[model samples]
Every structure is written in C-alpha cells, then in structure tokens.
Target: MDRDDETSSTPPAPAAPARASRSRQLRLAALLLLLVVVVAATVRVVVATGPPTWDELRERAGLTNRDRLIIGVKDDQPGVAQKLENGAFEGFDIDIAYMIAEDLGFDAPEVTLLSIESEDRARRQARDADGSFVTVDLVVASYSITEQRRDQGVTFSFPYLETEQSVLTLASDPRQVASLRDLERAKVCTLGTSTSEQRLREAGANPIGRNRISQCIQALYDGEVDAVTTDAAILAGFVGPRPPGELPPATKLLRPKELRHWDIGAESAEKWGVNTGPVPEMRDLVNLSLQQSAKGPDGDRWKAAFDRYLASEQQYSNPQQVAVGRQPEPEETVEVRQWPWERWALPSPGRPRSGVPSAARAPSRRNRRSSGC
Candidate 1:
C-alpha cells in the first residue's frame, strides 16, 4: 500500500467520546449524591419529630370533627350495662374515650348499646374500613384478647381486667369437688359458646352445653346439674352474697385455679373476622387509651368498682376451708452443728521440736560455707 493510503487508513483516536462519557458519569454520580442527601434530611426531620402526641393522634383520627363519638357496647349482658347505668361508662374506659375526644375538641361521646350476639361480634368489626364505626367510634365491650382473633385483622388493647374460669356449685352439697377429677362423676353445665365449657372438656370433665351462663347457674341451683361453669368474675358477680333474704341459705363460690384468668381488651376483626389486614394505627390508639386508663385516677376508680361489685362476692366461704382446716403447727425446731476440720501434725523422730528448726528447714552446708558468714 502507498504511504498516503496507510496514513489515511490508520484509525483516529476516540478521545472526545471517552472524555464526554466520563463527564456524564461524574454528573450522574453527583446527582445521585444530592438525592441521597435530600432523602437523609427528610428522614431526620421525620424521626426527630417522632410520632404524633396522643391528643394529636386522636384528633387526626377525626374523632373531634364528628359531633359525637359513639362507643359500641354489647347489650346482651347486665354486668356492663348495669355498670353503665351506674355511671361506670362515665367511669374508666368511657372517661378515657371522652377525654380523648375532648382533647380533640369533640363533644362528650354518646355510648350506643349494640346488640352484638356472642357469635356475631367478629363479623360486626370487619364491616368498617376505618377503625371508626359508621355508627360508632369504637367498641367498649368486655372483649377477650386472643391471638386467633388478632390473626383475623382485629386490633386489641392491653388488658383492662383479669378474669378466670370458675366452677359454681351448691353450698349444701356434701361432694366438695376441688378439681375436674373430683367432678368426674358429677354433672357439669356451661354455656354453649363459652371457654369454660372447652376448658372443662380439656380437663376431661363431661360438660353439658346450655344456652347461657344464667341457665347453667339456674340448673345448678335447681339440682338439674351438679355444677355450673363460667367465668369466675361473672360468677362472683352473680353469687355475690345476696342481699338479706335474696338467696337461700345454701349459696357458695370457690376459685380452685387462679392461673386460668384471662385479660380483657377492646378488639375488632377486619372483614368481620374473615381476613387479616392492617390495624396498626387503631391498635396503637386503643393501646394508648388502655395504658392511660391503667394509670392515674381512672385506674383507681375502676378498681374500686370491681372490688365493690365482684370482689365482695368472691368472699364466699370455701368448703376446703372447713375440710382441710387450719394448718398443723410447724414441727419443733432442731439445732445443728457444723463438722470440724481434721487436725494434722507433722511426725517428728521423738518429741516435738521446742526451739530448734526441723530438718526440713535446715540450710545446705555448701551454701553456708560459700557465704563464709
């Protein structure tokens, strides 16, 4: 090839394109760094502020904008309803709800009694997309806190009170059954949908399911059943020492196991207990209310109410009190002496050394001679 053709065929360097590509990459990196800084600043601001205050959270929940906060309460029971009538709703839970509403600048909440059957409670809560009911803001029933229900997308607050399963029997009966084993031969009755019935079955006791706890208690009282099983707290309320002349001479209550007690919390299922969904905000709100209620004046007031109504009834005389009787006097105390350490003495050829050092303590003659002391 000619020298001119060779010079023309040699490829020109692509330095300009390479320099432009490097410059573009640097610009992109700088832009990315700027975005990271902006995002970091925004996150810092949000974290520094933390979540909204309880009052702010309640207000943001839109409770204040509404004319009234309606709380749904199950109407099938007399305990909660009776307390409501006696101004207990005006007491702890209700008072807390009202305070939350008032802080948000809303009117005192009006409690709406809803007739939610024991079986349908899960369904009612699922219908509301927001935590608020289209007809009420929240449910204040004596709902039990359970993991199975929680999995159904229901939010529950910390427990307000602790209740347990108890066996209710007649006061005059000679057969004092302290456990399920003791009641193996006796007839046990419980409500159809009650946990007490299930517990009895688990304990190996044959339980006859009835419609309501009241019916079971009636059966026990009338001798139709040997014992009635129900929540201890409710039983305590029912058997509360009847006002003079109310209950006959033969009525007593006992609680054999205290560990069976369960805590009560406010709960609502999503899709009516059909599906699990987000309830973090609602759960937080209820938990906040429960925490607040558990402390301060509200807690004391409710405790007093519980003591007055339920605790008094649980004071019934236990048959075991008469059977086991007082504990026998403790065995007389006995004195003990610690063992002494064994005494040891080194053996000497004859008598023990007086002033002379033993052979084991003698210095080497070679060392002594070398020292020339």
Candidate 2:
C-alpha cells in the first residue's frame, strides 16, 4: 500500500490525556448530580420532621413544673383567643392550651402565654428572647393544619376544633361587599402568607397584605381595605357575635344565606393545628392527649375545654361539623422518651443510615498484640 493510502486508512489514535479528561468530566458530572439529589432529599426530610422532643426541649430550657411553658397565642382574636383587660389570656384556644399542658402534667398556672400575631404563628417554634435557638412548645392561635403548611416545616398535632372561612367588612361600608365575589377591584386585608391571602388571590381580589391581623383590622377600620377575610370563627370573634376584647371596629360577615359554609384557603373547614417545631415525640404525646383527653377521670379534657370557651361562641355550627371527635388511643404504644440522653430503637439492627448525622463516624483503630516470643 502507498504511504498516503496507509496514513488515511489508519486514523490518528485519540490522545491519552484527552480521554482521561473526558472520563474525569463525566465522573464529576455524575457526582454533582448525586450531591444535588442527596441535598434535596435531606432538605425534604428535615422539612417534614418536627422540632426537638419535648423532653429534650425541657432539658434545654432547664424547665421544671415551676417553669411555665411559653405558649404562642393571638392577642387580637376575641372570644376564640385574646389577652384580656386583666392581663390574663382568654378564649377557646387558651383553654385548649391549658388542657394540653394539663395532659402533659402541668397545671394551668404553670403555663405562660406569649402574645403572637396571626402572621407570626408559623414561626412559633423559633428563637426565644435571649437569642437562643428555641421555639414555643405549643401554638394555639387559630393555626390551621394544611398540606401547604406541613410542607413549610410546621409540624401540627391532630385537629382539636373546626371552623369555616368567612368574610369581614365594616358594618358601615357603602360597598356592602360581603361575599368573596363581592370583592371585585376592592382591596381586602389579611395576614401575609396566610391561607386567606392565597385564597383571596385565587378569588381575584386586590389584597392589602399586612404583617399581623391587628394590622388587617386597622386597615379594615381605616377603609384602606374594603373587607377583611378569614375563618368564620375568627370573623365571629371580630364582629360582636362573641367579642374578644374591646370592639376594634364594627364589622359584619358576608355569607350566602342558604349555605352556612364558606371554604376559604381551599380549606374544607378550618381546624386548629397545635404547632410544634421538629419535636416528633411531642407531636405523638399531643396526639395521645387528644385520644385520651375525652376518656378518663379528667372529665374529658376536650369537653371541659369546649364548655369553658367554645360553647359560648355563637358562630360555631351546631354540635360542630367535626372531622375529629374523641380520638381513640393508638392500638400500639409509643416509646415514652422522657430524657435527652436516650436512644430510640432502629427499624433494623443494620439499616442504611439517613438524615444529617449529628457527628462524623470515626474509623476504628484496632490494637495488634504480639504473642510471647
């Protein structure tokens, strides 16, 4: 074969360095993808998990029976929940809070109520006054348990009370905008990032978002917004159906006369979600309380709380349209981890590890011994 023909027939071999570089690039790309997946999975798990266990939190705070649990509560909400003129907290939520604490072995006086605006309820389990990483042990501020909220790292106990979405407008408004549709280009006010805000957006209304329900109330009273919308029970608390504190402004609900139901926030009906941080065990305890609160010598804690606060609220439906009533204890018992320096049983003796490790796994150093010579 001629030299030219031989050269064309045997094409040049790719450079070794180039091949190695291409292989390294592929491996790096794979590693990057794997890292992204791992991080995303970790984030999802963390978001789903509740705050520290109740015992752990108690220990961290050096809490005792003498140490009152700082509970997050809404002060502006009237009969449903509010700080009274006498400086004591009142309402249905306040009663529920005391009941939960009582179930956890704390007396009513052993609990402390922290005034929380509706907007700050989501952050109930957050930093404390000392700039310490702490959150409220329980949140009872008309907080709802929704899939959207659950996705946002807010852990909720089972529902204790149910409410419906409704609208609130000035009693003297010329527009008389009552229903959701009544709000055309008219501005509506609500706590920012709330279910009510989302629903209003969906309902095609101009929303005047505020940081707190107090702000929303002020906006409604000032006519900056034509109406304020939220849970019917909340609306009931606002209007004089059942007053919370001194009436802020005269407000009335806009509802269809035929349908006693109005589902805002795409909520089937509003239900109270006792919020905690990533305290899974606390959640379990709270759920157990719900189960047994109506069963024992405590005289059915829930019924007691209902009689104390909810019974008088004129807005709640008759006998209540409850999705949950007198929850029964789980057939299986949960481990009562009452201390921080304790461990929970793993699903299997040798299972793959997950979640962010609290510490790095140390390599074992074996000591070698020489037999006698």
Candidate 3:
C-alpha cells in the first residue's frame, strides 16, 4: 500500500456531483424521448380525424377505382335531356350531369352517358345501345323528387329545376285541354313510374304508360294517345326550335298553342333532383355540387340552363306553367371542415381600427335575395 492505495481509499475525491450530472442527463433524455412520442401521437391523431379531402370524399362515395363516371340520362326529351348523333349527350340534364361530374373531378371524356328511361331512373339503371343494363353513378334524367320515390330507395340531391305538370297535344288538334278534367276518359300518354300517371289516374283519365317521354310523344304522334302530359319544361324542349329532321315528322307538330297548363298546387310542380342511389355520402356530395351551382359567387348555373333550354318557350307557355325561374335552394346544408392550415389560407386579420367595435367592424347583415322554386 503506497500513495496510490491511499488515494483510492479516499473514494475518488467525492464523485457525487458527477453522479448527479449523469442522473440529470438520463432524465433529460427520457423527457426528450417522451416529448417526441407525444408529438408523434398528436400528429397521428390529427391526421386520422382531420377534415375530409375531395379525394377522400370521392373514395368514400365509391367513385375511385372506376374508369369513368357513368351518368344515366334520357336519350330523348329534346331540351331536358337527349343524346346526339355524334354519340354524345346534350340538353339541360346532360349539362347538369357535366357540371356535377366536373365538381366530382371528372372531365367530359371521363364521363360515360347511358340512356335511362323514366321507369329505370329510380333503380339507378341505364341501358347502352346494346340494351345491356349498365349501373350508373348518378341519374340526371329529369328525375322528380317525391316522398314516395324517396321511400322507394331513390336518394335525391337538391332540386335543380321546378316545373309544373302540363298537357301537350298536336298543334292540329283543336281540343282545349286546360285542366285534368279536360282529359277525363281520354287516353293521355305519360312515362311509367312518373307523377303524371298518378295524376292522370286521379283525374279519371286513362294514362298510357311509356318507358320514355319520347315514347309518349310518339304515341301522341301515332294518334294512339290524346295528349302527352309531363313537366312543362320537358314539353318546351320539344316545342323549341329543333334541327331539321331532329324529330319525327309527326312530333314536329307539337306547338305552343296545344300546350295546356293545369296551374295546380305544389303537388303538380316537378322538382327535378339528381338521383344518387342509396349512398348518403353520394347524395350529400351531389347536394354540395348543386348548392354551389345555385349559390356560387358568379351566378346560377341552373338559371343558365333554363334560359338556354326552356326560357324561350315561356312566352308561348302559360306564365303560371313555366317552372319557377330561379334554381331551388338545396335541401340540405353541407359542412366542410377545414384543415388547421386552411386558416392560413384565409386573409390574415389586421389590427382593429381605432374606436370601432368588433361587431361594427364585422360584415353587415344583408338579407339574402329572394328566390323561387
């Protein structure tokens, strides 16, 4: 035992401070690790429960993985919905389908149009040229929204057009059909599964059910039916100026003079809605698109369609029979939650002006302009 042994025996000059420093380092490391874990968990939760994205919405509504957005539309109805010779679809309903498809992230080429008859509208089924039953993502076939139809499993979006039921006869026909009673005991052609049939039955008229409005018109042309009854907007379509040879020689005879307005109650006004099948998400998404179209900043797309397709015929039509000119308000409100960063997307607030109350500085309350059905 020499000096080295004596120094060792002294316990290395009190190492408590170094031991305490090491303990603090270990604790700090543990604290940092815990903070990182907490941060990671918080990020995971925010991402999981965050606001929905458009892609997420599309996926949830089952639009993803599909090659195209298949929309069911009438192959013929003149102004309301129709297929063109170029294998493309045109007319108001087709325009509406395009608008909805655009909002749903599909281009014109990405949309496949299949002809859908009135009876098959609620079932969300359409037919290709080959007559194969094709499933469609939406039906924009001048579908009228009704409680009975809703109960029957047809989920409707917001009503896009409002037109009253009316009767159309050949211009050569001299009979005045101002009311349903006028059609009593007469064979009136109407689309099957349409409100027109029920209404005709109510009026003690014989409703000749057809698969399409074109069929009804054809029946009238063939003298197999006395009159064709449906939404005035639809009748206006055929009455409007058509390309030469667009209609049958007989259907070309439908003139404004022969159109009769019932001028009935709310039950007679057909509020056309997009059939979104049974998916509530799809319904809500379509409703959102309609809401935007009806209330967007620039103007109403619905009005544009109406003006382009049905407005001209209004002068010849009974003023009361024309659809309520403006687009109807959406039935449901859509709440799109914003992401945390979206707050930054908005303009940043400046400092409050001197002596101005917060409420006074806020946007003034302005009554929304009145709109009809």
Candidate 4:
C-alpha cells in the first residue's frame, strides 16, 4: 500500500534541479550561436569598406591638416611676397601662394604664413616662442628653381616667372654708368651666396655683402653703397615714383643690351617657381596651377596678379621682362609704381638674421663708400 502511494506522488515532478539545468543549457547554446552570427556580419562590413580608394586619398593629400595649409615665405620682399602691415601678405608671389591654396581647395583664411629665410626654404621648420616646432607645408617665396636647390630633396614647380639680374643706380650720378663693365671698383651691394656676388665682382665691383635685399636698398639710400643689384623685378620696386622722406625712386637701370635681364649670363636667367615639401603629388598640382595661369581664360589669375602688383613699365610676363638664358638690352623706359613703402609694408621690414626679424636699419653704414670710381 505504501509503495502505491509513493508512485502516485508523480515522482516529485522529475526532480526540480534536473528541469532547471536543461533550461539553462538551452539558453547558453542560443547565446553562443548569436555571438558567432554577429562576428561574421562585422567582418563582411569591414571587407566592403576596405581601404580608401586612390580618389579619396588624393583628396586627403591636399589637406596639410584638418582644415588649413601652412606655407613658408620670405617676409621682407617688396614685390615678390611682402608681409604687409595689416599682417596680410601681398605681392606677385603672395598671389601665387593664394592661388595655389585655392587650387588645393583651401580659402584665404585657411592658409597660414610662416616668415622664413631664403636659405631656410629647403628645410622648412621653425621654433615658436614656446619652443615647439612649426613645419611649413608649402613654400612660395621668390624661390629660384636651381639644380642645387633641387638636390636638397625639395621638389619645385614649373617655371612660372623668369627673373633677371639688374642694377639700381642714383639718377643724379653724373657717371651714368650704363653697363656692368662701367662699375669698376664701385661698392655694389649684393646678397652673399647668390650669383649676383660673383657677377658683380667679375664686373670689377667691390661687392658689399648684405643678408637681405632690403638692407641693400637702405644702404643705397644712405649712400653707404654706390649701387644695389639683384633681380630686375626686385630693383623695379624701388625705382618707381615716391613721396618725400622716402628713398628717391628715380633710380636708373644700368642694363646691357644683350639678350636678357640676367647680368650674370644664361644660367642667371633663373626661373622663380614654387617649392613643395618633398611631396611628389604637390609638385604636380603646383605645376598644373602654374600652367592654368598662363593658358587659362581671359581673367587668367597669374595675368591678373601681374597687372595689379607686378605691373608698371617693368611688369612680368610668361616669357619674362627679358628673354630667358639670353643677354639683352632692357627697355629704355621702365614705369614702376612708387607706392609708399610704409603703406603695405612687411611684418619684418628687415630680413631675419640669426634670431628674430623685422627690418632694423643697416648698422649705421659701417663701411661707407669713401670714394666712388
């Protein structure tokens, strides 16, 4: 009778623990299957995206950073790329920099200018007051495209403007020295490490080495140096009409009637071009913009820049004021605009030396010309 009663108790519902364990096992199996499915789906999505295609990479390459481009440039250059009093940059080279920024899909405000030296163009880096490093993305100074500079690991754009060497002499000087040959032993101011130095010395000039072009100008105005010599475009900036209290703009051009403006010779007819940060793609892009400026529509950008900033009697052209690689007589009348120097001046009127820079007056004409030849 006891046995029948126990069997009729439903065997304690097949043991409560056994029932619970079977339910937990079923849930665990389902979770594992779900996790595996999710992992497979994620891998498929990753495969679909892959790496960015060439087109996308090309777009990103133009951006120096998230939203702006840092360009290295010379600050004191008057006609090429002067850093203006308003903290804005102006000149033919400045215009070129802006155009390049635009072509790379950047706007005016999106570009940053770092004042650099002519020597520092190849290695683009500077230290801030806080001692951090600042690297330039592009360089648009009056940088000359030379084989030596090219070997420095920086790539240059196609020749956009051709610059020729020329001389600036006093208008009142009775000598009226017309050719390089006439400068026998006269103190001539020229930049060191430049071909102008050798050429001036060869021409029998007592070359006065100045670090920046502005110094040479100051020296000439102060009568410290008899003459200032450099690229014609550079000299033209000073020869235009001027207001009182400023350096006399009535300077004379003692150019030869040979083939070109470069007094140094065929090699001296150097092409002023843009420099890229060792970026092969950037070289291509810059060249394209340069080409468009010369070959594009009526309102060609480069032509417009030439009209506004570089124009006068000595305006720039694609082929240049004088023929490249040839010595020629300069035009009889060169009409350059003599705007006030202080009007849209550079951030640093003087080129940078070992330390900081702005224009400081030449050291009291340390070596004044005692006699003129």
Q: Number of backbone collisions per candidate, in order?
A: 2, 9, 0, 15
lDDT tens digits, residue span 1-373, model 1: 9999999999988799999999999999999999999989976776566555444544556644555545554422323222222223221223333433332234432333333334444444412324443444555544555677768655554555555455656656666555655667567887665556666776677789875454566566567777776554444434433343221211222332211111212122111111111444444555543443344233443454344334433344232110111111212211111112211231111112232112321111110000000
Order candidates by lDDT, high to low: 3, 2, 4, 1
For candidate 2, lDDT tens digit of each residue in 133-169? 4467778788877888889888888777776666666
* Residue 87, candidate 2: alpha-carbon lDDT: 62
Candidate 1, superposed: residue stretches over 4 Å from native = 1-49, 59-62, 72-109, 125-137, 242-278, 296-298, 317-373
Over all chains combined, what TM-score does candidate 1 have? 0.52
lDDT of 1: 0.42
Put the candidates in TM-score order, highest first.
Answer: 3, 4, 2, 1
TM-score for each predicted model, relative to the true structure = 0.52, 0.59, 0.73, 0.61
Report lDDT (Cα) of residue 44, candidate 3: 82
Instruction: Please give, for residues 53-160, the per-residue lDDT of candidate 4 as tens digits.
Output: 222333546654458778887656555656544455556677778776665656676677777666667777643336565888888877767787777676877766
RMSD in order of candidates: 29.2, 23.0, 11.1, 16.4
The candidate, 2 or 3, that scores higher on TM-score is: 3
In model 4, the Cα lDDT at residue 307 comes to 53
Q: CA lDDT, every prediction?
A: 0.42, 0.57, 0.69, 0.57
TM-score, candidate number 4: 0.61
lDDT of residue 228 for candidate 3: 84
- Which run of 10 residues does model 4 get worst, by summed lDDT? 364-373
Which candidate would rank higher by TM-score, 2 or 4? 4
